[model samples]
Target: MPIVQVEMLEGHTLAKKRLMVEKVTEAIVESLGVPADKVTIIIRDMSKENFSKAGKLACDQ
Candidate 1:
């Protein structure tokens, strides 16, 4: 089994996330030799305020 964790800023549509999961799972299955059913994709969404870049909060910058 392969577990893939994807963290990104919030606001992506459900369809985008679904496509992301499908593509990621397919990549894992092909590259890592994991079965399609055994590949797990976890998406973590963080608010702009909760994410920082270059020492500044995303929302603040």
Candidate 2:
């Protein structure tokens, strides 16, 4: 089994997240020759305040 983790600022719709996971699973399955069911994906949705870039908080951008 392969584990993949992705973290992004919150605000995406369920449809987008579902599509993202589907594509990610497909890529993992094809690359590792593993079953889709055996691939593990972890998606973390964080608040803008919790993420930062260029020495500034995302919420402040």
Candidate 3:
């Protein structure tokens, strides 16, 4: 079994998220030779304020 975790700033559309999940699953299955059913994907959405870079918050960038 393969577990994939994707964390990003919130606000993506549902269609985009669906496409991402599909592509991620395909890549995992092809690379690890695992069945699609055995793959687990976890998507985490965080506010821009929750992320920072180079001493600046994402929301401030």
Whichever of 1 and 2 has more TM-score, that candidate is 1
Error of 3 at 1 (Å): 0.9
Superposed on all Cα atoms, the candidates' RMSDs to the truth, in angstroms, are 0.9, 0.9, 0.7
Best-to-worst order by lDDT is: 3, 2, 1
Give the winner by lDDT.
Answer: 3
Tens-place lDDT digits, model 2, residues 1-61? 8999999889999999999999999999988899999988999999999998999999899
Judged by whole-model lDDT over C-alpha atoms, candidate 1 comes out at 0.90
- Each model's lDDT comes to 0.90, 0.94, 0.95
Cα-based lDDT at residue 14, candidate 2: 96
What's the true lDDT of residue 60 in model 3? Answer: 95
| Model 2 collision count | 0
Model 2 segments more than 4 A misplaced: none
Lowest-lDDT window of 10 residues in candidate 2? Answer: 27-36
Error of 2 at 18 (Å): 0.8
How do all models score by TM-score? 0.91, 0.90, 0.94
What's the distance in Å from true for residue 40, model 1? Answer: 0.8
